[model samples]
Target: MKLYLRFMGIHFRSSMEYKASFFMLGIATMIASLGGLLSLTFLFMRFHTIAGYTFSQVLLCFSTIVMSFALSEVFFRGFDRFEQIIRGGTFDRMLLRPCSLIGQILFEKIEFNRLSKVIEAAVVLAYAIPRSGVIWTADKILVLILMILGGVMMFAGMFLLFAGICFYTLEGLEVLNILTNGSENFGHYPVSVYGKWMLRFYTFIVPLACVQYYPLQYLLGRSDRSWYGLLPLAGFVFTIPCYCFWRIGLKHYKSNGS
Candidate 1:
């Protein structure tokens, strides 16, 4: 934990070195995210709802996904861009260190610029809570917090899986973006709106629904199932397999002499 804090402090100071550029890039990212928010706004203006979900309900979902994705990018982008480290031979050097490979990779880059999206998402969430028609309570608030944290875990897992694949390909796969970025885009609305098969794939396969759809149903009072609130825990579980795959890739890398 102390080592992690040290790495974070170094990165924070480095990011602070060029304050103008950092702020400009952060503003750019925030503005870019507004495009989606505007599209959702225009669509809702034309039709009151998507499927049966109210605009605010959809906003709640959007905020959660954007917040989670932004947090994941801020923390796990090193893994997302893991191929670069491998190509540059930095990963080989990383393997020589006595520290955990995952921790080292995690601290290699910390994208504070992505925090702009987190800010935007928080603004949207604040606007959404009262209008989202959710009857707030202790459990509901806890579930909402879990939903964001679980989403972070899910995206981090996706990044891990992407990095694991780089061991064989030696290049980042664009297809995997369909899981990481694509999920965030689609998650603007409820996962159920996608269709049964896609929903099932997200639920049973990727576990996206565990973070968004199921707990959201309980939050909105659409379902009476208390267990729905705990479904987000599955997102944490999803990381186990992803980490195993990463270890397997590490083993392969060691065997192949980088």
Candidate 2:
């Protein structure tokens, strides 16, 4: 962990050298993320609620997803653009390092500019907390935080799956936006509102419903037992298939490239 931090510090320093560029991109990203907030605003303006969840409730969900996704994106940016490294022969250099391939991949890119998403989501969370009316308990709040972390891990796994797939095709792909950006689009509202098929996809396929919906059901006092609060932990299973896919892709890379 110390070595990883040191490596990230180096990347951070490199990124800091271009201060103006970083700030500009950060602001641009901030504007785009804030613009996304309006989609939820407009939806609430028309219906006031979805699947029994209020505007603030929806905002809270969005906050968790956007904050966590952006956090991973900022640090794990190498995975986000893994093809660039593969194409540039950087992977060969990485293989020579004593560090783990995954750790080196994580250290290769640190987009400090994406920190704006964290700030923006925090602002939304601050505004939504009081308005949502959930009596904030320590355990409940802890569970809520875990849900955010789980969301980050799940998305990071998706980014890794996307990165690993690049090893096979040797380039970035866009259809993955369905799981990454596409989930961000759907996560702003209650998954329950999306009908049966969407609910099943979120539940069994992507596990978005596990992280956001079932656990949220307990948080809002709509649930009788507190056990539902921990259900988001189930979302971690999504990472298994993602990692398996990554391993298969890695083997394919070695076979075809050499």
Candidate 3:
């Protein structure tokens, strides 16, 4: 962890060299994230509730997913841009180091600009938590923390999957956005609002509802199922397959040989 922190400090100093550009991109990211919030606000103005969920409740869900995605982007961005690293022969250099490949990849880049989205999400969460009418308890608080952690892991797993695909294709796949960015856009509301099939897809296939919908129901006191609070933990299982796939890809990797 100390080494990781050192890497973070180095990355921070490097980013700070271009302070104006850094702040400009951060502000742009924040504004882009706010566009989603504004769309939600306009939709609620037209209808009192969406699928029986109040605006605040929907905002809670939106902010949770956004926060999770922002965390993933900040930490796992190396995986997102793994293709470039491979093409530039950085992967070859990393292999020569004694450090773990995954760790090196994780620390290769730390995008401070993405923190703007995280800050935006935090602001939305601060507003929604109180207005959502949830009677907060220790258990509920723990569940919420787990929900965020699970969401982060799930999205990180998606990024790993994306990286693994790059090993074979030797290029980034734009279509994978359907899982990463697309999921964040669609997740602004509860999965149930999207209809039964969509709900099932998120729950069983992507496991997004495990982190967002099921656990959120328990947090909001909409369900009596105490187990719902722990459903987010199930999302962690997603990382297993992703990691295995990454190993498989590593075996097939053909270095740029620089």
Candidate 4:
């Protein structure tokens, strides 16, 4: 952990040396994401609701997913873009280190630029909390918090899996974004608002419905049972396969020896 922190500090220092570029990227991302907020704002203006979900309800779901994604991309993005490290042989530098490759890979990069979304999500969540007007109970808040954590873990696991796939495919980086970034983009609305197929894919396949939809149902008092509130924990399942894939990829990389 100490070595990981040290590597992270180096990356932070590298980014700090280019303060203008960092802030420029941050502003650009915030601007792009504000367009998203405006779109959601107009969406509420049109129908007032979708699939039985209120505007505030959708906003909560969006904010939760965005918050988790932004935090994960901010910190866990080393895994998100690992193909570059692998292709350029930067990964070999980690093998030379006494520390675990996972730790080294984690600390290779830290993009504070991603925090622009985190700040935006925080603002949106803050605005939605009071306006949404839930009864504000411990169980409800816990469900929201748990869903956020589970969503982060699920998405991060996907990113890691995509990185692991690089060991085999060595291309198709953009395709992986269809799972990671696309999920976040689509999550701005209730997963139920999508088709029957999408809901099933996000639930049993990606576990997005487990973390986002079911818990939101519970939080909104739409669910008849307490188990709905606990469903987000199931998102943890995504990480197991992801980590297994990563281990297999690591072995393949070592065996290839190039």
Candidate 5:
């Protein structure tokens, strides 16, 4: 963990070297994230509720997904851009290093700029919390934390899956973006709003509903089942298969020899 922090520190310093560009990009990211919020606002102006969910409830869901995706980009962008390292001969050098390949690759890129999106999400969370009408309790608080952390893990797994695929294809796939970025965009509303089949796909296949929808139901007091609070843990479990797939891809990897 100390080594990871060191890597983060190094990336932070490197990003700070170009302060203006960093701030500009950060502001740009923040602005782009706000567009989703604005659209949601306009939507609720016409309809009092979406699929029986109030604006604040939907905002809670949106903020969680955005915050999670932003956090993943902040820490795991290396996986998102893994093709660059392979094509630039960096992967060959990585193989020669004594450190863990996954760890090294994990910190290959640290996008501090995405912190802007995190901040935006946080602001939305603050606004929605009091208005959402959920009776806050100790367990609800814990579940909320789990929801966000679980979301981060799930998105990180997606990024890792993308990187693993790159080991074979050596280029990023657009379809995978539909899974990652598309999810973030669609997730602004509760997955349940998307209809039964799509909700089932996200729940069973992507497992997004485990982290967001199920736990959200518990948080909103719609379900009294205590087990729903732990649903986010399933999102953490999702990383296991993704990591195994990554290992499989690594085993079959051939050097680009750049």
Candidate 6:
């Protein structure tokens, strides 16, 4: 933990050295996030509800997922861009260090700019929470928090999986973006609104719905199942397989020595 904080502080100080670039990137990210929110707003203006979900309800879902994705981007960005580290021979240098590989990768590049999305998500939540008409209780609040945490884990797992794939190919895969960034772009609304098959795929395969859809039903008073609130915990299982794949990839890695 102390090492992690030290790395974070070092990165923070380094980032601050280029304050203009840092703030520019942050503003750009924040604006990009707001574009999605504005699109939703325009759609809601045209039709007040989407698949029977009120605009505010959808906003809640949006805020939750976006917040989670932002958190993952901020913390796990090294994994997301691991191909660069591999190509630059940074991974090999890390292997010679006393620190854990995961720790080194995690702290390699801390993109604080991604916090812009988090701030935008917070603003959306502040606006949507009361208007969504969900009664807040301790359990419900806990469930909401879990939903965000589950989404973060799910996204981090995807980033790890992407990094692992690079070990064999030694190049970034664009198609996997469909699962990472693509999910975030389209996942603002409840998964059920897409289709039964989409919902099933997210639930059983990627477990995106486990964090966003199933538990959201309970949060929105659409379902009375208490178990629904706990479904987000199931999403954590996604990390196990991703981690296993990463280990396998690490074993097979043949460094380019760049």
Q: Would you list the C-alpha lDDT of every candidate in the order shown? A: 0.93, 0.84, 0.93, 0.85, 0.91, 0.92
Measured over all alpha carbons after superposition, the RMSD of each candidate to the real structure, in angstroms, is 1.3, 1.8, 1.0, 1.7, 0.8, 0.9
**Model 1 misplaced stretches (Cα beyond 4 Å):** 254-258
lDDT of 1 at 3: 99
Better of 3 and 4 by lDDT: 3
Residue 183 lDDT in model 5?
80
- Which 10-residue window in model 5 sums to the lowest lDDT? 219-228
Candidate 3 per-residue lDDT, tens place, 1-258, comes to 899999999999999999999999999999998899999999999997998899999999999999999999999999999999888889989989999999999998899999999999999999999999999888888998898889999999999999999999888999999999988999899999999999999998898999999998999888999899998887688999999999999999888566
lDDT by residue (tens digit), candidate 2, 149-224: 8888888888989988898888889888899888877887768889999989888888888788877888898889
Ranking by TM-score: 5, 6, 3, 1, 4, 2
Q: Per model, how many backbone clashes are there?
A: 0, 0, 0, 0, 0, 0
Clash pairs, model 4 backbone = none
Task: For residue 225, give model 4's deviation from the true position in Å.
Answer: 1.8
Assess every candidate by TM-score.
Answer: 0.97, 0.94, 0.98, 0.94, 0.98, 0.98
lDDT of 6 by residue, 1-258 (tens): 899999899999999999999999999999988889999999999999999999999999999999999999999999998999999999999889998899899999888989989999999999998999999999999999999999999999999999999999999999999999878988898888899999998888888899999899999888989899999887688999999999999999989977
Q: What is the lDDT of residue 188 in candidate 1?
A: 86
Off by over 4 Å in 3: none
